[model samples]
Structures are given as structure tokens and as C-alpha cells.
Target: MVKVEIVEEKDQQSSANSPYASTSSSRHSSQESISSISSELSAEETLYDRINALVDIVPPATRHRISTKVSKAVSFVKTGGKIMGNIVWIVTTSALLVGLPLALSLEDEAKIVAQEREMMAQQQGAQQMLSPGSAYPPPPGSNQTPQKGIVPPGF
Candidate 1:
């Protein structure tokens, strides 16, 4: 009975290890690489499998085209210098376009500031010249003249 039990266990282990124990698995290659990659994918799949499938598609045409474009771009950059001459030209032109107006406006601003200072100084001078006795001088015979004919308070 013990010998029979040992034989049964060994059979079950071999059955489990086949990988093609289920019907879904296909192609049993004897090469070491193919044998090593026996476990291709699983039945209960994930998002990673879907994404990997998308990247694994290698059409011969797209690969060649992509590599050619990359090599062409590399060669062009190696021949040409880092900075494009047109960019420097455009930058200088734009600086002059924008800076000229600002430079001209600064001169006008100085003139306007000087005119404002002169007007304020004139106003201050006029205020200084005003009499301390009266902002508006009274007409001739105003109230409370303190004359000889007038009666004094409490008199």
C-alpha cells in the first residue's frame, strides 16, 4: 500500500508539471529557450497583458521607417550648429521693435513729469503769496467795524 501511494503521488506531480495539462496551451518546442518560455500567458488576464500585447506587435515596415527617421534627424543635428541663425535674427528684430516704443515713451514721460512739477510749484507759490488776514478781503463797511459812532458791548 505504501509503494502504491508513492507511485500515485509521483504521477500527480508529473501531471501538474506538463503545463499543457489544460487544453489552452499550444506548441511544445524542445529548444532550451522555447522550453524555458513554456508559461506564455494565463487564462485570467490583466491590463498589463493587453498593454504588452500592443507593444509586442512588430511589423517590419514601421520599424524600418521609424529607425530611418531617427538616423536622419541625428545626422542633420550633427551637421548643423546648436543655435539656429534665424532664431537669433528674429530675437534681435523683436527686441528693437518692442524697445524703440518704450525708449521713445520714456522721453515723453520725462516732459510730462516736468510739466506737472512746474504746475504744482506755481500753485504752491500762489498759496504762499496769499494774505494771512483774509483769503477773501471784506467790502468797505463790514460787520463789527469798532468805530466811534457804534455802541460797545454791554454799554
Candidate 2:
């Protein structure tokens, strides 16, 4: 319970004879009034206080049910977050494990194709050299017939 009092304003000349007459006394009274106003403002219900008051109005059984539902909702959100995090981790790990090896294998296959092309080019150049109108003629005493069944060294 609280009680409030209202005082009527008095003329300055009349107040000049009162205890609040001196400059220091007037300042002190002003400070007191400001502090009292601040205290009254502070005494007003805050948002949290109002919410608590509303909650107190509900029946105990209803309050319990509401709290339980809220707790479950919070738990569900936390669990869903953890599950999403795990899914992301799994996807990233799979990409590293499977995709990395696949990329490396593709690179190796490309190298093999390049090597095969180089081998074919070399074979073509050797055949050109052995042709009749070749840049270099055969030695004077050697047989010019093509050799039939000899495989190249690195084949």
C-alpha cells in the first residue's frame, strides 16, 4: 500500500521566510524532489515483473504444462542444430575421402593418355626414318630390307 501527498505551490516571497529559504536549503530540497521522482519511477512494474504477474495468474497445472512444452521446444531446437552440424561434417568428410581419390585417379589417367600419345608419335617418327626417301641413306655395304619381328626395347 502507498499514499501520495500533493502540496499547493506558494509564492516565492512567502517561501523566502521558510526553512527552505537559504540557497543551500533550496538546493537540498530540489535534490530531494528529484530523488523522490526517480524512486517513484523505479517502483513502477518492469516488463519482467509484468510477465511474472501474468504467469502467476494462471492455474498451477496450466503453468506446468506450458513450461513443459517450452522446455521440449528448446530441447528440440538444440537437437536439430546438432543433427545439422553432424550432416555438414559428414558431407565434408565424404567429399575429402571420395572426391580426393577420384580427382587423383583422373589426373593419373590423363598422364597415361599423354604418355600413349608421345609413344605413338615416336613410333611414327621411327617409321618415317626407315622409309626409302629418308633424309639419311643406308650404309654402303648393309642390307636395306626392313627387319620383320624385332620389338622396340621399351615396348
Clashes of 1: 0
Residue 96 deviation, candidate 1, in Å? 1.3
The CA lDDT at 76 in model 2 is: 100
| lDDT score for residue 125 of model 1 | 58
Model 2, span 1-155: residue lDDT tens: 89998988668877867775666776788888897764332456686876777876899999899999999999999999999999999999999999999999999999999999999999987886667755454557767854556554557
* Top candidate (TM-score): 2
Per-prediction TM-score: 0.31, 0.45
lDDT of 1 by residue, 15-111 (tens): 7687657434344334544767635566677768777677558676887898899999998896664466667878988889998888899999999
After superposing candidate 1, which stretches have Cα over 4 Å from the reference?
A: 1-83, 133-155
Q: Highest lDDT, which number?
A: 2
lDDT of 1: 0.68
